[model samples]
Target: MDGIVVFGAGGRAGRAVTAEALRRGYGVTAVVRDPERYAELAAEGVSVVRGDVTDAGSVREVAGGAVGAVHAVSPFSGPEQGFASLDPDFFVKAADALLAGLASAGVRRLIAVGLFADLLGANGRPVMDDPAAFPPEIRPFALAHTAGLRRLREAGEGAVDWLMLTPGGGLEPDAPRTGRHRFGGERVPEGAPGLSYAELAVAVLDEIGTPSRHRTRVSVFVPREARVRRT
Candidate 1:
């Protein structure tokens, strides 16, 4: 059977995607910076490769023979990688490196994890730009993620076949999966923001099998009932 390379397979979203792909009987290569960190996945019959997407050559080598790749790499680390590296532009840098690596590896199809950039405030600007958009601590992350979306658009268009899966709500673990979701682009959708990372993975893997949103930024909206229970 063919395989898929999932960069940052250690992350929550990446792990979900890996497991989903494996459940469907597709060979999965879990790529991470440190192989030891993802030893558990290796034991699960996955081909774990200690590779960094930041290093194009290494990714190129690791991605060989894979049918597709997922850009789940994120550089924000409060203590593990140091908080100083959490800049919006740094997100762009990592994405660029991943793009170069994918291109060199001959992988044409890519489904990336992106943030909600289409959320506009009264000022006609992204909610991330508003000081009150979110708590100060998390604002930087939102900004960086939004910037990541722009970087994906600016870089991925025409160069690579890519889909930026922007979930409308927080990546909630408890959110119910109805196998249902709505898709859109640019402008953010209105409703409660809560998308199960597990369900989000389904969207990613589904697109990989039969991609229709090539080189575009798309958002998924789960039903409001899926996010909150009735009293």
Candidate 2:
């Protein structure tokens, strides 16, 4: 897209996504809770706006005048690293504000950053369908993310063109970007490989430039065999 807004621009994945969007020559405005936290982004010539993710008015202000909005707002902290205590309703609320803001401003395309737990597994089952599959600590967040995707999918039909990028389990700071990734249907392959945040950013930018991949959710990953086995 020629012009786009990115929420959570200060976040880990958000930074990469914004950088990629800029690399593709798309004008970008990065929404952040504290603009100071992302000084580097500001120095990079990106338009940075201060706004709270939980506030509709604030989110709306930044969402205006952009052709595409990427919902990359994530509030997770490192130590806790779990979603059980996280408010599930906040996701829905954010969606409401985002959609409302888009509707009022005439912006129609939405690209969201979602968790892989909502994706279907090898047996045609959602990743959350097999709760026992992952560590107990992370299940709650996974389920909540799945719910968020459902809400986005439902709201997208009216006028917004939405696509959710469900990142694999092993996202990391150093994930590689070969600029090539595989797109699967509802069910992702077994052993769910990992993808670098940089690569995920590239994928999102690709979708932004190519509108045909709309109203869809796809997983980001690298094959297991290509992964380096660590000790």
Report the poorest 10 consecutive residues by lDDT, candidate 1. 222-231
Tens digit per residue, CA lDDT, model 2, 1-231: 467889888887788889888888888999987887778888998998897666767767887778788888876654266555588776777777777777776788888888776777766777766756555566666666677777777775667788887776667788667676555556665677777788778778877777657777877676766555331
All candidates: TM-score: 0.87, 0.87
Instruction: Mark the regions of model 2 whose C-alpha exceeds 4 Å error after superposition.
Output: 79-85, 129-132, 224-231
Instruction: Supply the global lDDT for candidate 2.
Output: 0.75
lDDT of each: 0.76, 0.75
Q: Summing lDDT over every window of 10 consecutive residues in candidate 2, give the lowest-scoring window.
A: 222-231
The local lDDT score (0 to 100) that residue 213 gets in candidate 1 is 87
Error of 1 at 95 (Å): 2.0
Q: lDDT per residue, candidate 1, 64-157, as tens digits? A: 7777899887776343454566766766666777678878878878888876644664567775666665445656677777776677778735
- Stretches of model 1 off by over 4 angstroms after superposition: 77-82, 121-123, 225-231
